[model samples]
Target: MQVHECVSFILLKDNQVLLEKRAQDKEYDPNLIAIPGGHMEHGETREQALFRELEEELDIVPTSYVYLCSLYHPTGELQLIHYYVITQWTGTIVSLEADEVAWHSLEANPLDIEADKVALAEYRRLSLSLIIL
Candidate 1:
């Protein structure tokens, strides 16, 4: 089986994180609420893909971000997902691809995808460790 790689980001600002409701007609996770991101194209590095995806999905360019972790999951399509926490960015955020988007409290656990939930837990762990350091 061929494994596909992708990147997802948690966009953070002022104690809130950006979340999106995927379009109901999307092929993968239709109507699910999760952080916004997309798959990598051929010949692109992870950061390149990240930047492109952020631009395409959110209409913003991330200026600051940190890699959180990667996860492997086998669904109909196998995936190796690289997750990141983006703390700073430029341009106003407007959802260009999702059905709807909003900012939610950082403490809220509202994500609907299992991979997203695991990625968020890893983000929270890293955030706490940073505060202690």
Candidate 2:
């Protein structure tokens, strides 16, 4: 099985978090809300991959970002997901790939939305440090 690395960013503003709904035609988790991100290119570093994915999917460039954590799944095809918190950015958001995008209450229950629960929990758990960093 091939191992893949994926990067995601949680963009926050005024206590709300930006989320993107996956296109209905997408192969995995169609119509599910998720953080903005994609697979890393062959030679790209984690930060490079995050920047490229954010640009491609949201048409914005992060002015500053803080590494949150990584998740690894060993079942079936191996997957390693790197999570980041983007404190600032440049350019207006344009949904280039997601089906829909919106800002939801940061304190909202993750189960109430179609997002990645694990990552959401991690973000909430580290919200304080993330803001301080």
Per-model TM values vs. the true structure: 0.93, 0.85
TM-score of 2: 0.85
What is the C-alpha lDDT profile of model 1 across 4-81, one tens digit per residue?
A: 999999988787888999999887888989889888999999999999999999999988888888887565688888
Off by over 4 Å in 1: 131-133
Q: Give the top-scoring candidate (TM-score).
A: 1
| Tens digits of per-residue lDDT for model 2, 1-133 | 6878888888889888888888889765567667767889999999999989999999999998888888864433466878888879999999999988899887773332323567777777766665544
Worst-scoring 10-residue span by lDDT in model 2:
108-117
TM-score for candidate 1: 0.93
Residue 14, model 2: Cα distance from true site in angstroms:
0.6
